[model samples]
Target: MRALPAALLLTAGGFTAAVAQQTAAPDTMVAKTISNYSAKYMDAECQLTKGHYKVSSGATYLSTAIERGSIPENRLRALASGRRVITEAIQQNGQDKNAAAWYYLGRIDLHLGDVAGADSAFKRAEALAPGCAQDIGKYRRVVYAPIANKAIDFTKANQNDSALVYYRRAAAWYPASPLAPYNLANIFATSKMDDSALVYYDATLKATMVDTAAATVKIRNQAGYNRAVLLTRKQRWPDAVAAFQQYLTWVPDDADAKKGLIQSLRAAGMADSASAMEKKLGVTAGNPMAPAAVTGATADYNAAVQAYNAKNFAAAAAAADKFLVVEPNNRDALYMRARSYVELKKGPEAAKAANALLAVDPMSETALSLLGAAYNLTRSSTQAVNTRLRLNALPFTISSVTAAPSGA
Candidate 1:
């Protein structure tokens, strides 16, 4: 999975399909993920010199059924004890040796450190059901600790061997889960199995085209991104470019991957190719939008720019206020409002904007520095620090919070 799991939001994209059957798909409410692997993918073409690629079509869900729910705690316990949830499932009139039951059992064991048991269970699942492994992964989704998350602390802490044991189990339970194969491919890459990594990377992409559990936009983009990074490492510039382009299919605006595509082209000595990428991205030489997306109270946050440029504190403050009223959540407005507060000698108000900015995005560099700078502005330094820290650490994003900016 990418560092950003925003694709989870896209999982809800299939809600329309699910809602077609029922009023609302509970799974849509949880992951908001949509699987379109069943959609077609044969019309892909790649050209290195032209620095271009094309796909004949995109994807959409083939089936109306959408799976919901997380790996049940009981299933995890069962796998740990070398038990099969399929037993209970069969007794309860569910399918015997159901891949779904086995996958959940394996997932629970995987996280609980019963790596060997998880593997055996997964193998059993695969043996019992061959073509359905990937479909089973939909049942093993874990919000807090998805099986694909190899970068998390617990997996790294135990060393990859232990994690690999469970990961392998997950893959066994869901061969269609592109995430497992992709992760395993990275494992091989790190182990210097470039060839093996490439194979698995291909497998990951192939699996992704059919894996319902990983059809979210985030996961889809991540699959392409990770594969492209590996292709770059292998010095397969053409393939690298192709994979990155596929990534753009999901996240057309990912600056990081776009930068990587340019860098890779440069490294491969494909100047024309690199230039075309630049043209595609408009990065070689293009002016940014004349007016930024500033939702200020006034129409001319730009007019206030003159005062701001002149360092006129009073005028800047007045304009900043107008902007704040109209568009408090605006990034530039928030920063300027905070700055204006400082100049107006309103330390608390400035600090409030700093805090507000932090809520919207804790990673904001300007916000972080200003919040630190505002530390000495008032006796409430301790409060400010704690608030800023909490704002930063909260699991959800501030922009996602519908409430107006605190500074407003």
Candidate 2:
């Protein structure tokens, strides 16, 4: 997936070396520092292309270091040192004059799960000169494309083992791309390879942190939901509860997920809480909402879906919103609205819808889906994690917590 437009924020006319020279006196120290790191970066790229697995491994390690929650002391020190130097360069000489420094900082920020920082730095580098630091096209053509092709061909032949190897190769060569790990996780999950699926699922989430392109965001949404499913299957009650709750924020009306959440709550020794939730959700009721309201909401939802099916995302969002203004807690309308925002690439707007939906039903599947996408798009990993934690801590102690109406 390509980086977002922010990473290509340069104007029509790119900066030239001559222009840079004329801008101000060259800070020799900053230039030398950036040049040295640029050489190392290029060397790493070259080594990766030459089949040096270590280079790719280090890249993968760096990409996932922050996402994994804990880091070895030595690795932490190395990361801090690298970031320090890059910050120093930027402070001493503005990013515009030191394109390489910006480029390296982008790479570092991307690896550290700071997508916004990375995109800004990449934009600065590209603005300095088109060929400077953050060139994804060359990397795609030279590295990712070939291996991805091989992986696809192998998958077409039903050669899972061969496909897995190539997929791993692609992921290892460039950990920034979510395609490899996401697909790998899907394949493993489908094959009931739980352990393998978990590993790739983790990788998929981590990779998504670096690149939140539309395609990657979709994949990340799927991975996040499915990882929760896997956790439930493994009987990891606490984790499953958190995952299912998180998943619901994206897809509020997923009946299966709702049932799973209750099951997880019970299994985690919260049977009383689960029973209360079941009662609040009216799980045993034959029909909940008044028929008139249901019919109206359904009609509005269908109209929204029709627009969405026509790929008129803006229309779909508008229709959903029109319905939501009347039926604020209509699960399907909330989902359609949030999803349309996602398709429209309005990350902040999408997040607003998702957050609003969450306030009514914290476990809405559709809202949660868009929430993850929005957070990734805005590079708000900390916010996303904190949101999950807060949701996980929701009091479901028997009658202590009252569940929202299930669109009834």
lDDT of 1 by residue, 1-408 (tens): 111121221222321232133222122211221222212211112111111110000000101111211334543333333223232332343333444444444443343444333444455555666764544344344321333444322344647676565455456545655656666676677677788767766776776675455333334555566678778877888888778878877666555477678867776677777776665544542221112233433344654555666777667667767766655545565666677677666777878878876544443445666766666577667866875664343221112212232222
For model 2, residues 65-144, the per-residue Cα lDDT tens digits are 33442445654555445555555444433433555555555555543434334445655755665654346434323445
Q: Can you tell me which runs of candidate 2 are displaced by over 4 Å?
A: 1-142, 284-408
Largest TM-score belongs to which candidate? 2
Candidate 2 positional error at 136, Å = 8.2
TM-scores for all candidates: the values are: 0.37, 0.40
Candidate lDDT values, in order: 0.49, 0.59
What is candidate 1's CA lDDT for residue 80?
31
Query: Worst ten-residue run, lDDT, model 1?
Result: 54-63
- Runs in model 1 deviating more than 4 A are 1-158, 185-200, 211-215, 263-271, 280-408
